[model samples]
Target: MRRRFCRPPRLDLPSLFPEGSGEALPAVHKVASLGTPRRVLALLFPRLPVERLRHPGPLAIWAAQGSRRIVLSLSPEAEAAGLEPGQALADAQAILPDIILVPEDPAADVALLDRLALWALRFTPLVGVVGANGLLLDITGVEHLFGGEAALREAVLDRLARMGLSAVAAVAGHAGTALALVRTGWNGLVPTGEEEAAVAPLPLAALNLEPTLMGVLHGLGLRDIGSVAAQPRPGLVRRFGPALARALDEALGRAARPITPIRPPPDMAAAHDFADPVVTREGIEAALDALLVDLCRALREAGRGARRMLLRAHRVDGDVQEIAIGTGLASRDPKHITRLFHEKLERLEPDCGFERIVLEAPRTDPLTGVQEGLGTTGRTERREELAQLLDRLAQRVPVWRLAPRASHWPERAMARVSAFGTVEVPDGWAPRPRPVRLLRRPPILQVMAQVPDGPPFRLRLGRIWHRVLRAEEAERIEPEWWRDTPDRLPRDYYQVELDSGARLWVCRAGPMGPDARWVLHGHLP
Candidate 1:
């Protein structure tokens, strides 16, 4: 079954005001500035020569001549002259002797409009994107809050001008009339029934048509909106297709248009603008406390807790100082967040007075209650204390100053491991039953020794002669023959206990060969 939904009544504010005041009302002056003009230049001129340089493109240079900077369409003359919509100054200059500049970044313009739309949310949520650089907001029931439509428009315009943006706005019966009127530099509002009369005089280009389509209409002698509106609907559709017909209907208030708004994330963010810039630590802490309270309230309302908080201090000198802290668990408790900030506050140096402070909770989750009976003097607390102690020891001592010894391989039985705090110790691992005094790297020994497959009776290491009192052969480990290099001859490893209660890890290179040699690798510690 086909279903029908009733259309909501259009928001009308004209009835409440006097006859001349409502429709003939003067538009408030507002401005919307695109901060990143280079981005705009890039979007307009992809092949412009100015992009070849390492620095910023010459937007100001191109915009110097108003006529050269204005373009009617993307023409072959435009392309041949190195004039794309968003070309760089150097590239444009190289191709065309006379060209005007139009900055490129569509994204930045879109962003600015989006921000304006967000601020407009305070007035009305029914706002929609209009073309690439404009926004349409339906301020129906919201006019009363600002005292009237004229007052509301004034407030919006004042806020925009303060932010350094220029905008043309009109309140009319239809979107088409409003757009046409704004382009004609008409500031006053248009009456409900007068939309058709007001829009008829404006050029067909005001319908937001592509350059080609507008050119074709101009060629056909249909120069304005009234000419297009007067044509038969079927004939217009047959000649220009459904797009033109639909656009006509939309402009004449026969069709309804809706808008979507960009909303902030559910996580809370609060900002404080100071009456005067403050550079002291105390001033920053005070601002942080206020923001924290606001953020906590927001999180509580959403039934969530923050796990991480970021504090940003914007100084008057254009420097932005940021500090971040994480709580291992989720918590919306203002005291806890304030305590974390207190610890980090000591590290920040507020060089110049800060004009604004912003607090953001980027990560949050539902909170779970703490467990009971977890005493302050528990094993977990002791472990944490021990870890801290070890961390301190590692920072103070060099990595080469410590060793771990075990009775296993010849050179590896007593490995020389780093003493850094980052090293992981394996669980359930036990040390060998050997003497604690071990050498860092086994010194090479000259042996007037005996036995080919047995322990040596006499040897000299580091100018000290030692005789074997008791020797227990641990076992022989041969190097894999396929993996042996030219310098690495196969050797048999051995663990020998010396006469002075010291155990040594030793290896014989070129094992039992004609060129046999004795070399010590390490000692058991």
Candidate 2:
């Protein structure tokens, strides 16, 4: 017999975050897609520190980390004065005594990066935040949608400039390679399969490795990526370890570095800032008409309809008044949506005066096409009109929806749902002659039955006694065999009319057993 051996499973170690070793980093999503891998575009904003500043001039701004006061980031003017990032505060002041220094705000920098990432979704959905001041996008096949890669890059840069942001973006075959190119000041599109060659000339520092690794690579005379790639893989792994080797492979497009795109941002928004504040309702209504026109135009172009809308009024005294409205379906009709707002405009109170007004659509869906004849009396048109009326009424009072549900018990068959939520059970599950109203809990009643299995001749409701003048044969309801419960075995429901011209729904717990209980469950109109 031949000897048999079993191999042990290999463990894949998690990558460590360079910025902070032990802390949990933001989630990175991977796309497992078919066909050729996606091409990534990395966007970097080197001026995040200066750009987010309220008074960013030719000043030097240094952010603090723990006790170290160093040059966090600087303006181009500060850089021309020989003041650079990571320089000691005392030393930076000694070099440029006139440098206007401010503390760094890492949170604001990250927030602006997030906002810009959301703004970048007009290009492609596959965009991710790289570190604190960068965004990675998987352009893939989406370049031609905006003409071409070069045009797309320029368009993005221009849009950011319009948004008061300065960004440099680079496109490459791989995310790692593209990120490297962006950090090294490489702008424009790098053709597919040329990522290695394009990034080979960049210095090792451009890879953004830890100081110790850079020092070791420098000592070994591996100053550029080309030199590092020439070394034997086994030796590099044995010396610098897996992170360095893996990075090199990723930059060369030999490894997978998938990007997790953020949630897409809402695009429907219109705002007007006023030089003079307006406090009257008439002024606000006039402003609303203008906002609706602008907002509806964008919605039409996108072929999307707003399901939920928000109106924000900024008061002169820093108070913001907001109102929200929802529709039964996605609709971009200006007249209809304006009418809904008109119903509730009286509730809007501008304490001092409104300085700015912004309208936003937070929830939107694809606009559906509906064709109608000249006269709008068609069945579909009537139902649509009814839905609209319900939507209008919903702004004032709650609209309750009732539908049949799946249940063995007669009283449990019907369920109530929200007006805009899911529809009810199928027609086959619905029973006939349902009572107008049903009680939440059935109350037991004392009854005198003249005959067995017959409707009660007289029943007591609370403190009153009523005699049944007319009655019908009891409908027997039984529990489903698969869903048997000892207590909910069977019920005999009867429709009975009292002498006082009132109808009632009563149920016997069992088939007229000696100890059977009678309960008043519902009332009929």
Of the candidates shown, which would achieve the greatest TM-score relative to the real structure?
2
Residue-by-residue lDDT tens digits, candidate 1, 480-505: 44544557665665667677777676
Score each candidate by Cα lDDT.
Answer: 0.55, 0.72
Q: Count residue pairs with overlapping backbones in model 1.
A: 23
In model 2, the number of clashes is: 1
Query: Among all windows of ten consecutive residues in candidate 2, which has the lowest summed lDDT?
Result: 1-10
Tens-digit lDDT track of model 2 for 230-305: 9999998998889998888887778877676564323455555566788888888888887777677667666778
Segments in model 2 whose C-alpha atoms lie over 4 Å from true places: 1-40, 54-57, 121-127, 137-148, 158-165, 231-242, 265-326, 330-371, 374-382, 390-417, 423-525
Supply the TM-score for candidate 2. 0.54
How well does candidate 1 score on lDDT at residue 360?
A: 67
lDDT of candidate model 1 versus the reference: 0.55
